[model samples]
Target: MGPYSGSKSYSGGEIMGLKVFFSVLAVSVAISGCAKSPPPAPNHLIMLTETADGQADASFMEVDTLEECESRASAAKKVFPMAKIKYIRHYCTHTNIKFEPFLHNPEPEGPSYVFGLNFVKDGKVLSKVSNFKSMTDCENKGKQVCVISYQNIVPGE
Candidate 1:
C-alpha cells in the first residue's frame, strides 16, 4: 500500500549496507590473498670431522641460517676440540639427502682442494664439492650467477 512496501525494491540505506558488507568482505579476501605464508622450518647442518686414524664423527644441529653453519664450521676446533683431526667438513643440504654417505669417505682421495660454495639466491649451499685438482677447477666448476663465493676450506685452528 505504501510507496515501497509492496515493491520488491531495496531502500538506499539497505543498498548501502549491502555495499559496505561486500566491500569489507572483498578487502578481507584481498588481504588474506596477499598475506605471506609462514617461513619454512630451519635446516640442520651436519658437522663431520675425520681424525688421523680415519675415524669419522658427525654431529647434527639445527641452524636457522647458513651463515650460522659457516660460523660454526669456522670454529670447528673450539666446537669439537679434538686432537689430530685430519679434516672437519660442514655440509648443509636438504633433509632428504642421507648424511651416512659423507661419513663413509671423509678423507679426500688425493692431494685436492676443498672449496665452499654458497649459493647467493637462497643463501644456502645446494651441495658440497671437494677433491678439486686446483682452485681454477673449483672456480670453473662453480660458475653460476647465484654462486656468492668459493672459499678454501681451512681446518679450524
Candidate 2:
C-alpha cells in the first residue's frame, strides 16, 4: 500500500505489539505520577551574637549552617575596628533541639517558672505559651515537641 493511504489493516502480531507498547507507556506514566519527593534534609541552626561583657545590648543573627555563622561572627568582630568587644558567642545546634524557645525569645516574661511549646509546623516555627504547674504537667499536654523556660521580666533603668 502507498504511504498515507486509508486502506491499511494491522496483522495479529502488529496489533499485539501496539498493545504492549501502550501498556508499558501507561505503567510508566502511572508510576511517575505517583512518585513522591524525598523529604527535606536535616538542618542546623547557628546563633551568632555580639555583646559587651557578654550581657548588654547584644545583637544576633540566625543562619542555617555553621560555616556561615562563623563567617558572620568574624565579620561582626571587625565592626568596631578601634573599639574593644567584650564577648562574641556563636552557637550551632540541631533544628530539633528543645531549646528553640530560648533561641527565639532570649528574654521571656515570667516571674514564675513556665513551660513553652516550640514546634515546627508547615515550615514555620511556632511558639505556644502556657503556665504549667510542673514539668510533668507540661509534658502531659500531649504535644510531641515541647520546650520549657523560666522567664523573669527584668525592670529596665
Candidate 3:
C-alpha cells in the first residue's frame, strides 16, 4: 500500500489460504528432500572380430587358425555337437544391433560391432578390428608383414 494501490488489511480468508499454500509447499520440499535410490549403471558391451597374419584384417580373419579367432567357437560347437559354425559364429556382435547385414532388409540404426581379437587359445594375435572408433588405431597400417593387403579392411569384414 505504498501509494501504488488501495490500502488493505489482512483478511481471515486470505491468511488461511496463504497458510494452506505454505503448508503444502513445506510438505512437498520435505518429501522431496528424502534420499532417493540412484539409477542402475549401464552394461558394458563386448564385440567379436577376426584377425589374420598378426595384423588386424577382417578378410584375413576368415583365414585365421581355428584356435586363433574365436575363444567360444569350440564351446558353441560342443553345445550343438554337429554345428559347423567356423565362420558362422566367427561373426558376432556384442548386442543384437550388429546382425543387420545378414538380414534381407537391414534397419538404418543397425547395431554396430566394436571388437579386437587375439587368439586366446593359440596365444597369437592375428588381427584386431572394432567399433568405427578403434578401426584407425587397430587397422593394419604397416607394410612389415601384412597377411592380407592393407586395403582389404572393411566394416565387419
Candidate 4:
C-alpha cells in the first residue's frame, strides 16, 4: 500500500509520488521528439565511344573523374607497356548535371559523385571521360597509352 493510502488529503508523500511521475513523463517526451535526416544524392554520367579498334555503347556509364580516368587509362597501358597516348579527347559531358541512376555494379557507404567538374586554369578544359577509345594513327600524336577494344569480350559475361 502507498504511504498516502485511503487519504483524500494532500500529503507530502502524495506530492513526492506526483513529482516522480511527471519527471519521467517529461524525460520520455524529450527523448522521442527528434526527427532523423534523409540520405544524400548520387552523381552519374554516361558516354559512348567509337575508335579504330571497335565501338562501345552503354546505358550505364563508367564512374570517374578526369584525373581518375587518366590514372586508370595509364594502368590499362601497363597491359601494353609500350603503349602511349597519342592524343586524347574529352568526348562529351552528357550535358545534364542533375541526372543520376542506381549503380549496377555495387553500392557504397555513401553517395559519391561519378563526374567531377573542373575549370580551365591554363587555357585548356581538362578532359575527363567514362567512355573512351583511341583513334587510328593514335601514335602519330605521341604514343598509344589507352585504347578500348570491345571486339573480343562477351556481353555481361
Q: After superposition on all CA atoms, what RMSD does each candidate show versus the true structure? A: 10.3, 11.0, 14.5, 16.5
lDDT per residue (tens digit) for residues 1-157 in model 1: 6767877788999999999999999999999999976434436565656635443434445566767766766776564555446445656543422222222233444332244343322524334434445445556766531111122233431
Residue by residue across 94-129, what tens digits does model 4's lDDT show?
A: 222333343333222343222222313221232332
lDDT by residue (53-119, candidate 3, tens digit) is: 2333222222123343255444544654353222223332222122122221212133333334433
**Which residue runs of candidate 2 sit more than 4 Å off their true CA positions?**
1-6, 38-107, 110-143, 147-157
- Score every model by TM-score: 0.37, 0.34, 0.24, 0.23
Best by TM-score: 1
| lDDT by residue (tens digit), candidate 2, 25-91 | 9999999998975433334332323333232222323466657656766765676455554443433
The runs of at least 3 residues in candidate 3 whose Cα sits more than 4 Å from the true structure, single-residue gaps closed, are 42-157
Worst-scoring 10-residue span by lDDT in model 3: 40-49
Candidate 1: segments with Cα more than 4 A from true spot:
1-8, 46-77, 80-100, 104-107, 110-157
Question: How much lDDT does candidate 2 score?
Answer: 0.46
